[model samples]
Target: MIDCTRAMETNDAPATIAVPQDDALRALLAAIVDCSDDAIVSKTLDGVITSWNRGAEALFGYAAAEAVGQHIYLIIPDDHRAEEDEVLARLRRGERIDHFETVRQTKDGRRIPISLTVSPVRNAAGRIIGASKVARDITERQQSEALRARLAAIVDFSDDAIVSKTLDGVITSWNRGAERLFGYTAAEAVGRHIFLIIPADRRAEEIEVLARLGRGERIEHFDTIRQAKNGHHVAVSLTVSPIKDSRGHIIGASKVARDITERKRAEETLRRAHEELEERVRERTAELSRMNASLRQEIAERLRVEAERTQLLTRLVLAQEEERRRIARDLHDQLGQQLTALRLTLEMLNAQSADQTDVRVQIETLQELARQLDQDVAFRVGELRPVDFEERGLRAVLTDYVRKWSKHSGIPVRLHATPSTGERFTSEVETMLYRLAQEALNNIVKHARAECADVVLERSPEYLSLIVEDNGIGFDLSSVGSIGGGVGLLGMRERAALVGADLQIESTPGRGTTVIVRVPAHAAATRIP
Candidate 1:
């Protein structure tokens, strides 16, 4: 009887339905939950955690076993718990919380900002059973948005023009500096072409730069002079970079512009000032040179006049010598013969009157007077004419004069000369050269306590050089000796110049003295009248 009742109950019970399709649907749902990166969680109407997916464990650092039995309020901060309840309450009322952004604490005590999409979980009877939420970590995106805000603030407050352009040459961004530079606000410039700020003539160059940017090229630090709204030119240094899309496709250009008009103006002003300064310096130099030349010309002219005076004085002295020569010749030819004849007569009378004692004495006295007069006349004639030189030429003249000087002073003298040298020099050159040599030798004899002296003359094709050197107690050349001590060097130098030559003197105290005269050889060569 109990077996028949069990069979009757089993027969009345419905057969078990097939569950293969439900198993397949559950597998698909599990795959979706495992694959999602966002945390997908469901909570009961009372705020108990009902479901936790893998993304929830990764996001909150809690596994399903740990979080499923807990209230969702655990992740909500104390300050935000009330708002979170209201959000869940609204979600349970079949309302959606679409992209509600809020901060939730992670299991590691980090407050993470998230974007949450919450909706109602419904039962088969269409009654709300719980709330489901899709939460995505939006911390990085929020930080990035804050960074962009700070960068924009910096660009807006900058003093330099910061502009951006589209690949089509339209202005997409204009900062405060750009508004000041081009006299246009962001409102007026955004959709306008960049060429609005460019001058008509310079637009082409800017166009070319933009075209290059469109081709994915960057122009860094491109310097150009651009026109301002006031028609004045402003020099600018521009750095442009290619703007790219998410896939790195060149889209437009971003540019930073710096105004360098002041620098350029300062440079131009400096250049002009430098040119003016140089011109002034050149003018002053030219004025100084002209003044210097004038002074030199005046000095030269004065020297020439003085030289003429010296030559005239020399001519006067020569004229006086000529007169003396004439007088000496007359005395030798007329008075010399008369004196000789009278002296001979007196000698004859003295001899003939020797028998008369008184007469003979008077005659002897007369004869002595006549002989003394004749001697006086001959001496005067000899003084007027250099008789030794008349017979012996220049070498004898110098030798005899030097010998006499040596004898008078008891100073030893050495003489050296070439006989052939006398034949080559004209009268004037010979005279000047002889005088210069004599004057140099005289200086040595008078002031130079010299042990030895050398006088040399060299005649070459172009010039004649005369050198007089002495191993003497030399004086300082700077000290110029006593005014009268050795002006002879100056006289020699002057004579050298009169003949178109130069004189050089080298002397150091306690060393030696050398006087050199370099004269053109042809200076005194005879010219046909």
Candidate 2:
């Protein structure tokens, strides 16, 4: 180094004996400059390139041959030409420019950031001749500095408390947010231990945090309690990360704390409210369950009562039928015999008084009266339920019944009956059909002022339909319910329901009335075609 510096300072030219040593020293210095990554060049006071190294060629995208003997302005951008001129003027005055940062263009006209260190170059006379320049690309350094400044600004202005701490638990940096959150200035907090904000009960937690940070672990959203400077406790969500030095070694910890006290209180209140709601729901469910049980019991009781009533009604109807049979039997046996005897007695009297014309005529009149009386008694017996109904089935009983009803009511009846197949439905079903037929005939006699009625009994594979149509002074069906329901409609409906049959009544004023009863095959039809 001394020999190179002495060569640059010498006033005289090198002697022949010293040429080998000087060339060796020159080659060594050239090798050093070529090996550098920065651009190294020497220029005259007028900005002309005097020397160019390989480092300069690589940095500006130019070879030594292309750059040598060229003006230094080849690499100086247009905007910085004035700056370069100033540099040259400063070099003329023997001034050195150290680390002067600026922009410079490349061989491809690309602009880059550079930091230049210019020193005065002198000849052997020790007189300043020109300047030697070393320029380093500082793009990465500038970018890193800008990023750091932006991050610092963000931390300082953030609402969260951001702080850095040493591995030994000492606070190294505290932002404004920490001051606002803890009620202490950054100056008062930076030099203190981390425990200044950590509650005494949480010191162990802090120790664990520091230990984890030393292991290069990041802690995120750690919920814990921290103390404020005013002696109040605050709930916080903390995010802690390890701060590493340039050598990638863990040096400290960075913590970001967010105040979550209000959130915590809200969550607790919601939990309590939810618990209270669940309790209410449980109570209401219990109440509903009890109510359901009571309702079920009530329904069961009603069903039982209805069943009893139904049984009683069935027995009453059966009893009434039995009584009718008894009365009918008594009338047929007693009154019929008496009337027959009375007729026989009148005939004997008439035969004996044959010679007296008036006496014979009077006896014959009494005979006729006895005959009519006997017929009336027979009719009354027939009006009661048919004794052969169970044995003969519904069709036989209904045929006989409709005939008697027509005669008693003095109305002509058209009975279109299906031939029976000698099959029988249940006793209840037969009784229901017989009674319904009986009731329809009775109603027609009472209300219908017409001359004739139709009783149609139809049998099909699917149904047994009985229709009783009357040419009567039919009443309005809409008024049937409101006008006292005097047509025995309710009774007919009940009887039909007992056999699971459908009963429909159609009537209009001044028209005919039709009573239809349809028994489904599955309901009561004992035979299928």
**Local accuracy by lDDT, each model:** 0.75, 0.80
Candidate 2 Cα outliers beyond 4 Å, as residue runs: 1-21, 214-216, 298-529
Error of 1 at 186 (Å): 2.4
Q: List the residue pairs that clash in candidate 2.
A: 9-124, 10-124, 11-124
Q: Which 10 residues in a row give candidate 2 its minimum summed lDDT?
A: 10-19
TM-score per candidate, chains pooled: 0.49, 0.56
Query: How far in Å is the alpha carbon of 284 misplaced in model 1?
Result: 9.0
- Please give the lDDT score at residue 329 for candidate 1: 96
Model 1 spans with C-alpha error above 4 angstroms? 1-21, 276-529
Give the per-residue lDDT of model 2 (tens digit) for 368-414: 88887887788778766355555667777777777777777679998
* The best candidate in terms of lDDT: 2
lDDT of 1 at 89: 67
